[model samples]
Every structure is written in structure tokens, then in C-alpha cells.
Target: MTVLGIETTTDVCGVALNRNGVQLDSIVKNEKHIHAAQLVPMIENLLSRNQLKVFELDGIAVSIGPGSFTGLRIGLSVAKGLAYSSHLPLAAVSTLQSLAYPVWKTIPATESIILSVTEIQRDEFAYALFRAIDFIENHVPDFHLITKNEKETVEKIFENPLHHFLLCGFQAEKFYSMFCSENRNVSFAGKEFNACSATSIASLGERYLERNVIADVSSLEPVYGKNFIAKKSNLFSRITQ
Candidate 1:
């Protein structure tokens, strides 16, 4: 299974090529606030380094975001174009879940619950709490791997206390604070794995693909989260009240 993965949810834009659930080559450029101009070329170079072409990929994975709105769009555009042109299956991975990789890796398989956080600026950040399931090897749709965003994200974390919970992402530092008081079972990632990367997305994407969980790219879209509905802070307005 040859899979190509892309991640551009924050200041980082990354591309990774994977063969049978293993990483072959990856390129990530830290443009911070400059994802638009840097993403394509980085991908081209990455593909070249790996000696591959767009059409050669069996499947393409994209980080469908809960990060920067424009950043997410740029990645989706690129992903859609590649999938359209090459006739490859589009696997839209969750940005919040990609951030959870470090949390998953640092801890063992025993840790079932994870509260992944990414800073979204203006006082709100992207968050997702995943309660890991039994490793059942099945192949379905990628989107199905993630339960849709329910209102009880925070509550879910508090309800089932696992061995430990991993929290890390672009805004992990800032976001971790929001749930610190509420969930006593939480554990955080240190500086090394703090940021988002395509490698992690690819790894998780590979896992999803193996499980037969996949989603059609045509119906795939970026998620900006419920926080972006209004311009100002939904969190701040509530806090001041």
C-alpha cells in the first residue's frame, strides 16, 4: 500500500510518502504564517526525493483541519487536485487526531483515552478526546474512524479515566490549560513532539487504511471547528460573564 500524506493545518506544511504503513520520505517546511506559498514546492521536492509521482500513489491522505481556515483550504485544494488528477482514493485524516499521535506514541497501547489539543488563537483551540478501541483490523472509511464531534468532548474525558491521556499539538501548551482543572487524568507531551507534522498524519492514515476505514475524497471537507462560527472568542465572552 503506497500512500501519500499531506498536512498543512498550522504554520507547518508537510508531505510524507508511505509504503505499507511505513514512512518512506517526508518534507515539512515551517513557514509559521506562510503555508500558501510553501506547500506545493515542498510536496514536489518530497515526491522527487522519494522517486515517485502523484499518479503512482495508491491512496492520498490529507489533514482535513480544525486549524487555520486558509491553511486547511490550501491543503484540501492540493489534495483534491491530486486525487482528481490521479484517480487516487482520498483519505481525509483529522487534524486534531494527527496531533494525538505524539500522545499515542509516548504512551503505550494501554492508554485508551486521549484529549488532543491545538491552539486556534483568540483564546480557543481545537480539541478532541479519543477513547481508543480494541485493535480490530478492519477496513472501512477514514472519517468513520473518528466519531463525529459531539458536545460532550470534555465530559467524555472526565467520565472514563484511562491509564493516561496524551495531549499535544500546535497549540497544545495553550489548549492543555483549558482542560487541566477539569480532567485530572491528563498527561502532556514535552517539547520534542509538540508540533503537528505530516509524518504523524501518515502514520495514523496508514493505520486507518489497514482497518478498512476510509472516506471518499469528493465528500471530504475541512473542519474549522464550532469555535469559528463567530469572529470573536466564544470562550472569552463566556469567561467574562
Candidate 2:
């Protein structure tokens, strides 16, 4: 089976092609907020270089959300459009889950936690904790939107000190100091393995396809972790006071 995977959850915009769950070719560009314009052409280039057509793709997989709000929309819109137009199935992978899969595949089935932390705002992060049980199944008990409050995070880390923790994702390095300061049991995944990979998305997508866990292209929505809270105006207060 042939599949295309798209990832646009962070600074990176990546597209990958997989055949039988192995990566064929991938294009990853870490440009600043350029996913809106760069994704389609990158996918096109990957297919053209491989001498393949969009119709030849069996399915499309996309990182649905919990990263950049705009990035998620751009990726899902493209995936939905492709799936709808080509009459192919769609797999919606969570941005955090896609990222954690790679790490989960590498680690042994020991008692441990895999933290996928992506930058949401300056000094703020969106993190998901995956409890790795085995190569095939890791459970994500919770994911949260948190700030740079070291105290609360440190407490959470120590809640289960016996379980080894592995950290990975965008801007994961920023948490190194905080996590490492008190708990040596937790470690960061190297820079090479941190960023989310479309390859992982493809692999996960292939599994989703096998189990008939496809998405409804007509009504699929990006999983924005939280609602966008617009900054309220102080003009009314000033006028009244």
C-alpha cells in the first residue's frame, strides 16, 4: 500500500511517502511559519521525483492538531481536500501521538513516560505524556497546555519517580534545564529525534488503515487543544471609569 503523510504542527512542514509502512521519500523544511505555502509544493515535488501521481496514493495521513493553530488547519485542509478529491481514505493523527510514536518504537517496554513537548507560545508549551507499554501500544493518559512554571511541572515529574521519562518534540530542549535540575531519571531525546516526522505519520496511518480507523473527510476538525482566547479590549473600562 502507498500513502502520503503531511505534518505542519510546528516550525517544520514535512511530507513523506511510504510504501508498505516504510519511508520512500520525504521533504522536510524548517522555515518560519511557511507551512501555508510550502506544504503542497513539497508534496508535489516528492511525488514528481518519485514518478508518482496523487491518484496513485492509497491514502493520506495528516497531523491534526495541538500544535500551532494555523499550522493544523493548513495541514488538515490539504489532507481533506486530497482525500475527498481522490476518493481515498484519510487518517487523522494527533500531532503529539505522531511525534511520540517514533520514540515509542525505539524504547523497550519498561516502566517509563514519554513526554512530547511542543512550543505553543513564548515560555509556554503543549505537552503530552505517553506511557510506553510496548513497541505496538503506548498509552497517552494526558496532555496539557502549560507555562514556564517550574514548580508545578517538577512536582508532576516526581509523582512517579520510578518510571523513567523520555522527552521529545519541538523546542524540547527548552525544558532540559527544568526537567534535569531535580530529576535525573528523566532524559531528553537527542536533537536528531526530537522533531515530528511525517514518516511516523505514514507508519501510524498504515496501521489505522488496516484497522479501518479512518476519518470522515466531510466533518473532520483540527484538535485545537484549547479555544483561541482573543485579547479583550480595555477601551470600555477606560470610557466608563
Candidate 3:
């Protein structure tokens, strides 16, 4: 399966071309907040260099949010456009899952737990817990948008002393320090595993495509993980508009 994967759920803007689970080419730019402008060109450049066309791709897979609102929107806009135009299936991979994927690929298969968390704002994060038994990731119920102040509650979740668990993703270091202070049986995934990779997105997407887990392009939306609140204007402010 030939797939084009996009990872822009964070500050990174990444694109990858994967054929049958093998990554052919990828581009990543971590220049803070330029994903909106860089994503499309990155995709075009990668496809052009590989001598591939958008229409030739079997599917488009995107890391559908829990990160920057604008970044996710830009990536999804492009992916949905390409999928709609090419008549290709669209696959949605969770941002946390993409972050957890590299760790899973490198970890030894054992009955362990993986906690994936990506920074959302101030002290808050987008987090999910996965129980990896025999190399399969079983997601624990209810994704969370947690803050540092909620450490006590988070601590209770990782208080399990029997299972070997790893905390990973954007703020792994921060979580590592927090968990270690409590003497929890938790380890960090390391600096190299910080950013989400489009290549990983492609691989996961390929599996989704094979399983016919395609998304409805017209209705697909990034998982914001929270309700968006629009600011309301007072009478005077509305009158000015």
C-alpha cells in the first residue's frame, strides 16, 4: 500500500511516503509555528522527489490532534483535500498513538504499560494510557487533558508497583521527574523519542487502510479532545463590529 502520512499535531510539520509499510521518504520541520505554510510544500516536495503523485497514493493518513489547534487544522485541511481530490481513503491516527508508536517499535515485547502525554498548554497535557500485553496496545478508557496540579490523581494511576511502565511523548521529562519523586515504577522514553514522526503515521495508516478503517473525508475532524469555546462579545463590542 502506498500512503502519504502527515504529522502536524504539534509544532512539527512532517510528511512521509510509505509503500507497504516501508518509508520511502520523509520531511520534518520543527521551526515552531510554521506548519500552516510549510506542510503543503513539504508534502509536494517529498512527493516530487520520490517521483510520486498525489493521485497515485492509495490512502492519506493524518495525526488527528490533541495538540496545536491551528496546526491540526492545517494538516487536516490538506490531507482531506488530497483524499477528496484523488478519491483515496483517509485514515486518522491519534496524536498520542503516533508518539507512542516509536517507543512500541523499540521496546521489548512484554506485559507493560505505556503512558503517552503531549503538552497542550501551561501545565496541561493530552494523555492516554495503553496496556501493552504481548506487543498489542490496549487503550485504557477515557483520554485526559490533565494539568500539573492534578498530579495526585495522575499519581494514583501510576501507583501500580507490579507492572513495568514507561511515560513518553513531548513532556516525558517533566512527567519522569514528577513520577520519580513519588517513587513510581515508571521510566522515560528519552529525548530521541520526543517528536511525532510522519513515518510512524504512515505505517499505522497502512494498517488502517488494510483493515478498511477509512475516515469520511467530508465529516472527518481532528480530535480536539475538548470543546472549543468562542469568545462572546458584549453589546458595545458587537456594535463596533
Candidate 4:
């Protein structure tokens, strides 16, 4: 099956084509604030280069995130539009799951844990934990928001000494240091696995397609992980007073 994947859950904006769970090609840009302007064009370019039309693809996959609010919205908007126009099925893949997928593939150990961490805002992070055995299983199925010093919750998850632990995703290095110690069996994933990738999204997208897991395009929304509270501007407050 051929699937088109869109990823805009972080600073990275990417589009990829996957056939039978293998990435055929991908185009990615790692510049902040460019997703709105560049996402659709990147998709067009990727499809054109592959000599494929939107209708010809089996399905569309998009990162439904607990990452950048704006980026997630842009990506889902485009994916939903395409799904609506082309009458294609949509798969909403977790942003954190996609981040950990590559690392999961590389680990040879029978039992391991992957902690996927990404910055949601300044000094705040969103994380998801997965247990990798024969396949990656979501231990903490939902993304949880946490502050820098909030290591107790995460600590409890990986407290078991039998399993190897891996820290990955956008702000993985910071968390690795926070979690790593002489007594813990822990390691940091390579820098390449730290960023979200369209290839991983597409690969997981294909699996979802095979399992008949399609999203309801009309009601789908990004998982922001935290409530958005717009602080009142000082000018507005003064005027009101």
C-alpha cells in the first residue's frame, strides 16, 4: 500500500511517501515558523517528484500531536483537506510514537523502555513512555505535560532494573541527563532519532492502514497535551482598570 505522511509536530516540516511500510522518498525542512507556508508546497514537490497523484495513493497519515500547537494544526488541516477532496482514509499517528519508532527498530534487547520527550513551551515538555519488547507498546498511552524538575513520575515508570532505558525526541538530551545515573541502565538515542520524521510517520501509517485503523476526518483534532491559556496583555489590563 502506498501512503503519504505529513509531519509538523515540531520545528521540522516534512512529507514522505511509503509503500508497504518502507519509505519511498521524503522532503523535510527544519526551520521554525515555516510550516504554514511550506507544508503544502513540500507535499506537492514530493508527490510530483515521485510521479504520483493524490488520488493514486492508498491513504494519508498525519501527526496528531502534543507538540507545537500551530504546526499540528497546519499539518492536520492540510491532511484533512486532502482526505476530504480525494475520498481517502486518514490515519492519525501519535507524534511521540513516531519519534520513538526509529530507536525502537534499532534496539536489539528483548526488554527496553523509550521515553519520548518534546518541548511543548518554554521550560515545559510533553512526554510519552513506550515499552519495547517484540514490538513497541505504549505504557503511557497519552502524552503527559511536565516541567523540568518533575522527574518523579518518569522515574517511577523506569524504576525496574531489568529493562534497558532509552531517552529520545526533541529535548531528549536534557531529560537523559535528568534520568541518567550510575545505578540506572540507561542510554541516549542518537541525535538523528531526536527529531520527528515523515519516514517514521509513513511507516507507522502503513501499519495503521493494514490494521483498518482509520480516523474520522471530520471530528479529528490534535492532542495539545495541555490547556492553552492566553495571558491577558498588560495594555488590555491597564485599559480595563
Candidate 5:
């Protein structure tokens, strides 16, 4: 199966092609505030270079985020559009899952825990916990927003001494220092694993596709970690008046 993955959940704007579980090609640019302008073009370029077409892809995958709000919208919009136009399946991969995927692939499933986190604001973060026993199960399935002082919540999650913890994603080091400093089994993932990847999104998407876990293009929404209240502006009203 061939899948096109779009990732714009943070500063990175990336597009990747995964064919039969192998990454065919990818384009990733870590530039802030450029996702709106460059995402579709990057997808086009990636497909063109890979000698593939939108209709040829078996499915489309996107990072549905608990990250940058604007970036998530742009990525999901593009992915939904492409899927709708091409009549392809859509997979909504979690941004946190994408951040932990690379590390999960290398680690043994011996009571290992992957803690994926991203900063939401000063001293606040959104986190997802995955336990790799038989397979990676999202032990903490939902993204929970918490502050640095919420040591009780974090400690409860990491109470298993037998579980080796792998901390990853944006501000992972900060979180580690804040909570896991004294834990002998806890460690930080490399800098490369700190960012979300389109490749990982694509790879996970393929698995979702195989399992028939496709997303509803019409209603699928990014997980913003909290209620997204849009600031009302009267610019349109003023212009109309």
C-alpha cells in the first residue's frame, strides 16, 4: 500500500510517501509560520519527485495535533481535501504518537514506557503515554494538559519501577528535569526524536489502513488538548457595514 503523510503540527512542515511499509521519499522543512504557504507545495513536490499522483496513493495520513493550532488546521485541511478529491481513505495520526514512533521502533517491548510531550505554554505541556509490552498501547490514550508543578500526576504515571521510561517530543528535556531527574531507568530520546515526523505519520497510517481504522474526513478534528475558543473579531462586520 502507498500512503502520503502530511505533518504540520509544530514548526516543521513535512510530507512523506510510504510504500508497502517503506518510506519512498520525504521533504521536511523546519521553518516557523510557513506551513500555511508551503505545505501543499511540499506535498506536490514530494509526489512529483516520487513519480506518483494523488489518485495513485492508497490513503492519506495527517498529524492531528495537540500542538500548534494553526499548523494543525492547515495540515488537516489539506489532507482532508486531498482525500476527498481523490476518494481515498484518511488516517489521523496523533502528533505525540508520531514523535514517539521512531523511538518505539527500536526499543524492545520489555516493560518499556514512552512518554510523549509538547509544550502548550509556559510551564504547561500536553502529554501522551505509551506502554510497549506486546505492542504499543496508549496507556494514557488522551492527551492531558498539565503544568510543571503537577508532580503528583506525573509521578503516578511513572510509579512502575520495572518500566523503563523513554521521554521524547518538544520540551522533553525540560520535563525530564522537572520530574524524572532521580529515576535510574528514565532517559531522554535523541534530539532527532524530539520533533514530529511525516515519515512516522505515514508508517502508522499504513498500519491503521491495514486495520481498517480510517478517519471520517467530514468530521475528524485535531486533538487540541483543550477547548479551542476562537477570538471573535468584527472585521468582517465592519467591512460589510
Candidate 6:
């Protein structure tokens, strides 16, 4: 299956052409806050370089957020347009899961837990913990995406970190330090630990596609920023026009 994956949910803007889990050509830019302007051109460039068109793709995989609001919108806008025009299946992959793969690739696979976190600002965060124990057993990273968020709660849940944990993402450093400040039994992830990858996103989408887990194109809403409704009071305050 040839899948075209587009990800702009965070600081990174990437487009990858993955043929059945193996990435062929991918373009990634990590210039912070450039997602809105860079996402489409990056995808167009990647597709043009590969000489592939929309009709040649089997599915459209997108990182359905928990990232930036504007970034998510820009990516979804293009994705929805392409899927609608090409009549292809649209697949959604979690932002956090996409972060887990590189970190998972670095570890021993089993007997270790991965705690992935992204900064949410306002002194809070978004995080998920996955027991990569299955990766070591030959089942190919069959771990569930577990939530460990809202600050104080995750701190309590992982008080004893004997299971060899690795943390990665935008605010991974912050969380790592938080655990240490509490004197929790957690290990640290160096600069060499992990970063989001388009190939990983494509691979993850391929897994869901093979399982017949798909969604209706029109029904494919941008993830993450779904709850960012305009505050009613704020709206009322600016109605002087």
C-alpha cells in the first residue's frame, strides 16, 4: 500500500511517501512556528520529487493532533481537500503515538515503559505512557496508548520507575526534571533520545489501515483542537461593531 502521510501538528512540518511501511521520500522542517506556511509546500515538494499523484496513493494518513491549533488546521485543511478530491481512505494516527516509535526504537523494546509528553503551556501538559513490553516479545510494538496527564496525577502514578522509562517530546525535558525533583525512580532521556518522525507516522497509519480501521473523509475532523471553542464571554466582549 502506498500511503502519503502529512504531519504539521507541532513544530515540525513533514510529508512522506511510504510504500507499505517503508518510507521512500520525506521532507521535514523543524523551524519552530512555521507549520502554517510550510506544511503544504513541503507536501507538494515531496510529492513532486517522487513524481506521484493523488490517484496513486492508497490512503491519506494524518497526525490527528494534541499539538498546535493552527498547525493542525493547516494540515487537516489540505488533507481533507485531497481526500475529497481523490476519493481515498483517510487514516488518523495519534500525535503521541507518532512520538513513541523513535523512542521505542532506541530502547530494548521490552521491560521498559515510555512516557511521552508534549507541552500544553499554562503550566500543564499532555502525556501518554505505553508499555513497550510487547515490542520485545516479537509482536511488533502492540502497546496501548495510555494517558498520564494533568501534572500532579502522572507524578503520583509513576512514583516508582523501576521499569526503565524514557521520556521524549517538546516538553520531555520539563517532565524529566519534574520526576527528578520529586526524587522519583526515573531515568533520563538525552538529546539523542527521540524526535517526531514522518516515517513513524506513516508506519503507524499502515498498521491501522491493514486492520480495516478507517474513517469517512467528511467525518475526518482535525484532532486536538476540537475543543477550542471560542469562549462565549470573550465573544460577547468584542461585539461592539
| Best-performing candidate as measured by lDDT | 5
TM-score of each: 0.78, 0.87, 0.89, 0.89, 0.90, 0.80
Off by over 4 Å in 1: 134-163, 181-184, 226-241
lDDT comparing candidate 4 with the true structure: 0.80
For model 5, name the residue pairs that clash.
none
Rank all candidate structures by their lDDT, best first, as comma-separated numbers: 5, 4, 3, 2, 1, 6
Candidate 6 vs. true structure, TM-score: 0.80
Please give, for residues 1-241, the per-residue lDDT of candidate 3 as tens digits: 9999999888788999899879899999988889766777787788889888787889999998788777777788788878876789999888888788888888766777778888877677888877665333231134788777777777787666787677789877876665445554777778988888899889888888897888998787777766763222121121112
* Candidate 5 lDDT: 0.81
Whole-model lDDT per candidate = 0.67, 0.77, 0.77, 0.80, 0.81, 0.67
- The CA lDDT at 37 in model 3 is 64
lDDT of 3 at 116: 87
Residues 53-113, candidate 2: write the lDDT tens digits.
Answer: 8888899988886778787777887788788777899988877878778888888777777
- Candidate 2, residue 85: how far the Cα is off, in Å: 0.9
Give candidate 4's total backbone clashes: 0
lDDT (Cα, tens digit) per residue for candidate 6, span 1-241:
9888878777778888889667898999988788756676677677778887777788888877677777677677677667667777777777777777677777774768776666545434566667786531221223222233444655666666565567776667776665434544456666654466677777777777887777676666655623764111111111111
Which candidate, 1 or 6, would have the higher lDDT against the true structure?
Answer: 1
Worst 10 residues of 1 by lDDT: 232-241
Tens digits of per-residue lDDT, candidate 5, 1-241, equal 9999889888889999999999999999999999877887788788888878788899999999888877787788788878877789999898888888888898887778788898866778988878776333351257788897787888887677777789999888888888778777778987878888999999988888888888998888877776785332221121111
Best by TM-score: 5
